[model samples]
Target: MASESPACNICESIISQTIQTDDRKEIQIARHTVNEHFDRLQRELLKELQIIENDKRKEISKILAPVERKEKEIDGLQISLAIIKQHASDLQTFLVSKQIEHELIDTDNLIQSIQNNSELSGVIVSLQTIGMMKSLGNISRFGQTSQSDMSLVRQKIKQAQAKVAVVTKGSLDHQHGTIKTEEGL
Candidate 1:
């Protein structure tokens, strides 16, 4: 079929040129015609896509409104829940602080009782004197051991606190860090 198509004649000619295609202008015209058709097809496809995209945008807007409203509702609920949680944490801290206050009152009473007792004070002094004498005897030999023991304890505390720091700070931001345990220990 392609071979059967007739060639067009152009104006200029080479010595050996045929009547069908004699010059560069004719070749350029043919190429331009094919390219124009291809360009037109591409433009039609793009226009079709644009129409489809506009329809999709309208459809999507209709569908998305309810989803957007539901998302806002969910966000509102989350914010409310966060506020409630914050209040609960605040109340918990208040309760703990109140409990600590009660325990501190008990501790103060006990400490006051001890301080007011003359007999207890004498016993404390004698115990301290005996402890001092014993420690003085071991001080030269056990000084390094005692220092190392203190260092080890501090190191353990530092490591533990490092691990606890994040949790502690976050909790404190949400609540409080006042002492709440019983005072005896």
Candidate 2:
């Protein structure tokens, strides 16, 4: 009976050792499977994160579209404004120059007319007989008339010159104002 008990104890020990070894092998298989599945899950997560990043980039671009369009519009408007300002400056210059040229021509014509009138008056006075002068008009009246005509012509020339100066100054002031506006912009 004692020998049979020893043999049964030995058999129990052997079964325990075999069970532990099987348990260890099962644990290792489970660990290997978990590790492989974890790798696949990590790859899937990385792919999804990349997709999300691409989507976010697309959304950001979509949000900025209107801003980009508005920036282009503002640039176009600025260019148009510059062109308009340049054209206005050109027109103002043309008008001012033309006005000055016309005024100068008018002044020259007035002076020529005055010289012609003075010459005609002198010839008339020199050729006039005393009786004819008396019959027509007094010599003082002729002198006064010629003097008044010459004085009126001189006044007109002076007035035209002053007007030209005023016009030029006004244009210059407008040009300066335009420059200031551009600088501020």
Candidate 1 lDDT over 1-185, as tens digits, reads: 12211221111122225433444556677678869987997798778777776876776566556556655655665555566657778776565556555555655565566458632332211113587578667855311211124445445545655667778878886553333333333
**Candidate 2 residue-wise lDDT, 107-179, digit = tens:** 5565576567553232211222589657656533321111124445445556666687799999999999999
Provide the lowest-lDDT 10-residue window in model 2.
139-148
List where candidate 2 sits over 4 angstroms from the true fold: 4-11, 72-185
Error of 2 at 53 (Å): 2.5
Clashes of each: 0, 0
Clashing pairs in 1: none
Q: What is the C-alpha RMSD of each candidate to the true structure, in Å?
A: 53.9, 63.1
Q: What is the lDDT of residue 21 in candidate 2?
A: 82
